[model samples]
Target: MTESLNISIQFGGGAELLFDKIKKREVDLPALKKYLPDCQREKWTIRELLLWIKENLLREREELFLQGDSVRPGILVLINDADWELCGELDYELQNRDTIMFISTLHGG
Candidate 1:
């Protein structure tokens, strides 16, 4: 049997506005193998997590949150308090209990 992956998600610096002003969330993701038949890997990556968030959590303005399968520029992504860029960005495999944060750097003047 496949197990669910549990993780924490946070939005900040105006990014929360896209998620109904919610700053934090606890998400349980389904097994990758079962969730995506084409996926051969046993682990979840930030890329998949972003897709999941767009489908399940993002409230509106998807264009503002995502761009061509990744987060739009000006949004900073952190995994467990470290920059996602340091963690390999979309290729970084997600671990149970990992805390992922998205902070928007763009703001209208």
Candidate 2:
């Protein structure tokens, strides 16, 4: 009885290199209802979405994209054009039509 979450994912500052060189994508994450009752929520949090991104969208070199269950250092995450840090970082709950962007600051190091 849950609806799909339509969101936009964008990679910039060379972060797209890790995503098959694609800079933007419109993705649909299934409703949290599909998860275990204990983990299910009214909406998907960034923490949960990160795992889903790693499993579904990441093409390779997970280590380069993630660190200890979160995005690696030197990478910037933005949610709906606002800094994720200001939006509670990983704890930010995502909503329909949300735009999540990842921009890597580390490149050619």
Candidate 3:
């Protein structure tokens, strides 16, 4: 069984394009941007991103429990740019060009 859904994603580059493919049921994680360079950081792949959604995001798990995990707003997922926890989390209703940005928030000096 395959379900079709579309969500808004931010961060520019290929995120927008990727969302289009997603709406068509194309599960190409970072479809648009296969490699997003970040100065001296490693670039994540489309495959990797999709895997993450299936492994974690799409997974039905505890709410607050994930808050303290590494995929939280400050560590993995962005609070403001990411999905709304109360709404549906990964299962949230995605619209055409909604806007989802993944950020690593931190409190450092």
- The candidate scoring highest on lDDT is 1
What is the C-alpha lDDT profile of model 1 across 15-35, one tens digit per residue? Answer: 999999999999889999878
Q: What ordering of candidates by TM-score runs from best to worst?
A: 1, 2, 3
TM-score of each prediction: 0.95, 0.91, 0.31
Residue 102 of model 3, lDDT score: 44
lDDT of 3 by residue, 45-106 (tens): 22334445545344243232134323344433332464455445544433434444543344
TM-score of 1: 0.95
lDDT of 2: 0.88
Please report how far candidate 3 places residue 99 from its true position, in Å: 0.5
Q: Which stretches in model 2 have alpha-carbon errors above 4 Å?
A: 35-40
Q: Rate the local accuracy (lDDT) of all candidates.
A: 0.93, 0.88, 0.36
- TM-score winner between 1 and 2, please give it: 1
lDDT of 2 by residue, 1-109 (tens): 3888899999999888888999999998887778535674677888888888887888988888899979999889999999999999988989889999999999674
Point out the higher-scoring one by TM-score: 1 or 3.
1
Give the residue spans of candidate 1 off by over 4 A: none
Error of 1 at 73 (Å): 0.5
Query: Which ten contiguous residues of candidate 1 have the minimum total lDDT?
Result: 33-42
Model 1, 17: alpha-carbon shift in Å?
A: 0.9
